[model samples]
Target chain A: MTTIITAQNLSKSFGSFQALKNVNLTIKKGQIVGIIGANGAGKTTLLNSILGLSVYDGDLNVLGFDPYSQRDELMKEICFISDVATLPKWIKVSEAIDFVEGVHKSFDRKKALAFLAGTTVPLDKKIRQLSKGMVVQVHLALIMSIDAKILVLDEPTLGLDIIYRKKFYHQLLEDFFDEDRTILITTHQVDEIENILSQVIFIREGEIALEADMEEITENWMVLNPTADNIDAARASSPASEQSLLGRTSFIFNGVSRAELEKLGDVSRVSLSDLFVTLMKGDNDA
Target chain B: MIASIIKPGGYNPFKALMLREYWENRRAIFTTPLVIMGLSMVLIIISMGLLGRAIHIDGQSYTLNEMIANMSAQKAQNISTHINQILMVSTLPIMIGAWFCMVFTALGSLYDERKDNSILFWKSMPVSDLQTVLAKLLNVMLVIPFVAIGFTFIFQIFLLIVGSFSTLGTDYSAWDLLWSSSNLPLLVFSELTYMVMYSLWALPVFAWFMLVSVIAKRSPLLLATIPVALVILFETLFFHSEYLARFIGMRLTGAHILQTDNGFGQNFSILGINTPLENIQSAAKPEFWIGLGIAAALLYAAILLRKRSSL
Candidate 1:
């Protein structure tokens, strides 16, 4: 497990507003990590800092290169798709392929063309003329063809239909992801990518509220459905969050043993979305 | 290996970036001059067809063929010189079209990307901000001008060939009168030299526009032009001198690229000279170099702005 990205005390501010607070993180190779946060929680800001698109205060390194100063050299191994439809609208599909082939050393033009061959995106049509889903497909086709070590995607499937969104992640996992590659993704639709992510980091108010592997999350976090009489006993375990619906209460507990939780009520594994909401709510409450 | 696939000599990144600039703005850089040339060719053919009818110039009536036949050799030489001059001057419209293309392209190069949020896509590439800005500068300063000149020269040759046919049955040899009298090679060399020098002279203006394009939030044209206008206005109001205004005017029109007897007429006389290289010497002055220094500084500033800018 080689560390590919290391951040120490990373912070960014615009005027008086701190977008990213004193943050520390380490991402290793061969891991698919999801950075989950609410709106304005500094998810995009963190991604920008990692991509060297924004300036920051504090030490950060990606693939042994300083992202800010050595971005050009760093980009040789790092590819990013920042939101859907970021590709220029005026660029023709063929021109886009030619441009990527010309600019990116690691780009495989034949693979990209092969990928596009299966789709309905016309090579002669400009990007603006394509539908939104088709544009994302074109962008994804180009990016997936690049033999980059790290793929950072920020809302890469935003505003797309469920079919396209599923296809996006499906292609990413099937064709792009491997032991030699890593992916860092951020999106509001957490459940859509939950199955693909090996690790998840929950951010709130510019700070990491929780970071854990999928196995660790399943082992340590549990959602217990407690009856009205057993609710007080379940609260004794210090649940992170609680929600009640139709006279039934679900309490998300962290670090409490399954045996202890089973004593109070029925316990079930915590879903990533449920754990994400629990951790974020706990941060807000604190 | 990927490195072998993208070896330095096999594909120059700078050249590719420049090619990308050309690709993005092909309509402005290549098509405008070509369309203008096509239209001019149609007009030239129609006007040549009308040459057979008698025409009155300065109250003297003569058919086009008789006018060429009746002139003395020296008089015909002068008429040939003037005719070549008119043909050379005919390229002005295309040149003007190219100039407008250069201005808008420079202004919109950085601004358009930022507006569309494609700056992120561009910044993600391995090319640095410095290379990107320089590629755009080269596009406006070198590529567009060269393309315009190439089209103009071809169109000029076509017109000269057509003129030779129109001048048949006259005493004057159309080959000697039009082609031989016109110093075509020297004319081309001077034009190329003039364009290169003019790019240097006008560097500050283009650099300023590019800087404005990167820095301004919106309406970059207004942001680019208002400051120069204010400077001229302030100079007129406070100092009662037009030096700043005149200097900007001269740079924009490339008046300082040559030592003309009169500022306006020397550009036209580029074709008049047999040895245009000797006459095309740039104005050797501290201001010229200083202006270049200013341009370099502005370009550097644009690169810095681009590095820091994000959507």
Candidate 2:
């Protein structure tokens, strides 16, 4: 796969405060990179700097074009989705599509309309009346229809229900995505994305906390729950500590290494949400 | 596999952005200016009827031209003065309002995308920063004027017809009255065209505001306004800050290049509605050309600044 987005020493500051400080990241084409961070962790700032909306002290290349100087060329290959309700408040769904058609030459009207047709959004209804989920669907329809090589979504499914969210990603993967397209999503809905995330980068306090592959993470990280009375035995065997009401326990153990961690009693694999919490709790030390 | 570059292409992104800008702002376009223009016309009709009735009571046998001549001389001075004021107040505010509305209409143009994390969408499009900002500037500079003119022109024509019916004593023909107002379209359009041409001189300011809008996390206008206000405040307290005042004031007035209305100042052997426009058009002043050249330079500078500034 080819490299789609590359960033080096990317930094953003607002007055005396730093929003992002000396960050470095890279995403290969066709890879789904998940950016997990709390609000104000500079996820959006990093994205904006890439899209050329915010000036940052860094070097960034999205599809071989500096997003700032070569925005028009870069935009041709990048599709980004934020909160869906922001599409256009007063416009009818059709008018919004006409607008997209105007701004972007790559916009596929038939596909956008087809996607809209698939939804319950009233064709002639103004966006102001639609529920939040409906608006997200409209945004999804338009974004999915764009023949862009890079798709950037920032909480695109904020208010979406389980079914629509699933359907949204499924359509994205099936209809809009291909082996050549790279999608970088920054969302709080981590578990929903765990299966799709080929790579994950955790950003904290304006710095990269961790960058890990999904398979390697699952292979290396395990959750240990010992029911045996001799918790001290598990504690001696484990490499990482855990908090519990009974006493201090540790999840780290050589016996539960990647090849045989499944044999341990009630040794459940960690979900993305669990992994994220672990990292959030674990990153301060790392 | 294919590469997209910001080369000069036949496609114009600015125009598309402009259409979206206007269409999104349909509410403000239809309502505010129409209300102001409608009220102004109503006042014109009432005042004309009152003036005409007084002429009848005085038993002065007057031609419609004579009455219009009197009105033009007396009320027309106020009318012209107020017309300029109204053009400035009603149209310019509406124009300024339209530009400001671009703030709301285009609030999300790029900011919302970034705020909501959709910059990736816009970045993916085959567009450049110059193209993006150019599209936005075109929306404010060109598209706003087109819509404002379309709305007010139709409303003005409607009022002129209504003003014709507003006549009393039945001696004045509506055709002649309309002819007076009918001649105004060219005057209004030409003058407005000139005003917009001059207004183009100030586009760097708007582009500056757009630059502010894109960067500010809170209110962009406030971010821009506070600094200028502080400078003004600093100058006011100093009282003798001639250098500061001269510097900012010169920059402000430098934008006045398209004032083609200072026509044939006091040189006419003959005078009429037909007179001023012809004199202005015929007597090509060096000032006009000089102003136009300066405005073009400013616009080019704005484009370059947009290109250099990230986002």
Top-lDDT candidate index:
1
Model 2 agreement with the true structure over B135-165: per-residue lDDT tens digits? 7666655655566666566655565565465
True contacts kept of each: 0.61, 0.41
Per residue, candidate 1 scores C-alpha lDDT tens digits across A46-104 of 99999999999999999999999988998889999998657998888887777777778
Model 1 Cα shift for residue B15 (angstroms): 2.4
Q: Which stretches of candidate 2 lie over 4 Å from their true place?
A: A8-24, A57-59, A227-230, A243-266, A283-286, B1-12, B40-126, B150-189, B200-311
Among all windows of 10 consecutive residues in model 2 chain A, the one with the lowest summed lDDT is A253-262
Per-candidate interface DockQ score: 0.59, 0.32
Could you tell me the lDDT of residue B194 within candidate 1? 79
Off by over 4 Å in 1: A283-286, B1-11, B50-63, B66-73, B261-276
